[model samples]
Target: MTNTNNSLNSASSKASPKCWPILPAAGVGSRMQADRPKQYLPLHDQFLMDHTLRLMLSYPKFEQLVLVLSETDPYWPDSAFANDPRIIRAPGGSERCYSVLNGLRALEGMAAEDDWVAVHDVARPCLHHSDLDALFSAVENSAINNTGACGAILASPTRDTMKRGIKQPDGTITIDHTVERDQLWHALTPQVFRYAELKQALEFCLQNHLEVTDEASAMEQVNKQPLLVAGRSDNIKVTRPEDLALAELFLAQSLNQS
Candidate 1:
């Protein structure tokens, strides 16, 4: 997991051979309104996809990186990830869950049955090393016998009063009520889990005809309330036009810190 620019060492010489990172980058960024996907958007010197790749490639222990992507993307044949010896590409699916399934399918041929996969979105570029540390700590105990577990996105708690509203056809909104400010947590990605556990959850969803929002929701369908490792607010998702600027600022700050 190293090149001339990156220095990496195994956490243990024996090497725990299971856990890896899987990135779902097949989404065409409709919100960005660009012909290209949001992941192809430029952030500083590297493309947004590169930012995501850098995060995992920067880590030393992950043996392989499975990128779930569209075959049609121009970024294909690109060296950002293809240059790495440990990087693998898997064709994406119709939905995020399905894309993950395709990734798991690729892993199924080679990885251990109980291997772990940390699923992350391509748009989230502000993930920190501390957040990664916290997530591993939460499930470190479960790694003992390979009965690995589920863990969710980290996000800062809400400090502002959340408002509920009704949108009218006239382009006006009415505040229905002020939602409770005390109980809210925003979800961000790099959501980690056992590959088999997630595969089970997705299979359950497919059988039950459920369309869940996040990976955690699919797991919840299977009676799993994943542990959340609170990540910083700076870890943001670029889902709308306005978020690009916010993301730019976060990226600037992130580089300065590093």
Candidate 2:
């Protein structure tokens, strides 16, 4: 909405930015068909969100973490890091974008305009240390290489054949066409960008009634290009009942590898 060029120029001139991790954990996963939110459901003896919180706080160390939670969420107090000094709590919103924006606002006093914010999903409990390392490395290299890349995200190439679906008159679905997977990347979490640019980009999208599914989408609306660094395919977001098992296995695999 504002002068994009001027904002970018000013940000590039600032000192190296620190990455702030923001995890949006407000969704009540109805698809999981569980009694409670998917994030609160048990995963390997602890709440599902506990694994994600631990992963974010431990790897690629930061001063603090902003956890966006629903205002009425009674389960958060039970989290292992609930009383941890490194954690900052922010109220969640109706949608993912709004929740992320609230998390950004939580750092108003501490975060500078050029500071970087890495938005990751709280449901993704199996994020590997290697993926975090790759994502941050790309962000740091972007400036050193003078690539002018506004942001960076962890993504993976689509391995399976993609298809476009079409609804039939009889309430059935059929393949409309086969989509090319060559240039398509399955966007993953830990999408990082400057604090001010991300905030402004999100605000502009909300003002114009645009649908922002992720932080990258908001940045795209402002004509900014983000680098897609390849990441492991196992970084899955636990949304359904069966995903809990998969996440458990992935977590175990990561632990064994470590």
Candidate 3:
């Protein structure tokens, strides 16, 4: 078994910025067509959210976890982590950005301005420990390099040939043009940002009515470019029903390797 405490202590000694984890679990999984929220669905005989929570909790560097849940979420109480003292509840908002902001707000008295907040998706249950380590390393390196980067996010360079599509009056879609995939990347979770910087960027976006897809985008709107740290492809977010099987497979494979 991994020595969680030792790992955390090692990371703390090397990493200059303290890190905290924020999980947004307010979505209803509309595309999943499931009876319950996708996070509440079963994965390896446990709630999907349970697996995600355990993964974050295992990281000893994190002082606490801020979980954003919908106000009326009945399944949250049933979660195995609901009673964990390390986990704090935050009221969910209408949009992902709002939910993230709420989670950040909950950290008011606890986290310092320069502390790093790693915002991860609750549905992504297969985040590898190596990826987490890499993310923290990248952020620390940026500070050492004086890159002026506000934060960092886990991302994967696009592998598939890209295309832009256009729909005709006949309802047939055709490629409008080929998109250059060289610089494109699929943004993943555990996006880490300095607490104060992230909060300011998010608030700026909200005030201007800008669409904040991810924390990186919000930072971008404020003229802050966040570093993209490459992560493993296995770190997939469970959206549709079909993704559950793949997540289970990845989790099992990861366990075998460990």
Candidate 1's residue-wise lDDT over 37-119, tens digit each?
88887778678778878887787657678999898877756537666778788898888988887888888767765566788
Could you tell me every candidate's TM-score relative to the true structure?
0.85, 0.93, 0.92
The count of residue-pair clashes in candidate 2 stands at 0
Across residues 1-258, which tens digit of lDDT does each residue of candidate 3 receive?
379988998888655657889999999999999999999999999999999999999987776899999999999888888899999899999999999999999999888888899999999999988899999888888888988988899999999999999999999999999999998999999999999999999999999999899999999999998998999999999999899999999999988988
- Return the lDDT, model 3, position 217: 96
- Residues 59-156, candidate 2: write the lDDT tens digits: 75577899999999999889888899999999999999999999999999999888889899889998888888888889888877989899899998
Q: What is the lDDT of every predicted structure here?
A: 0.78, 0.90, 0.93
* Lowest summed lDDT window (length 10), candidate 3: 10-19
At residue 239, give the lDDT of candidate 3.
95
**Collision pairs in model 3:** none
Residue 51 in model 3: shift from native, Å?
0.5
Count of clashes, each model: 1, 0, 0
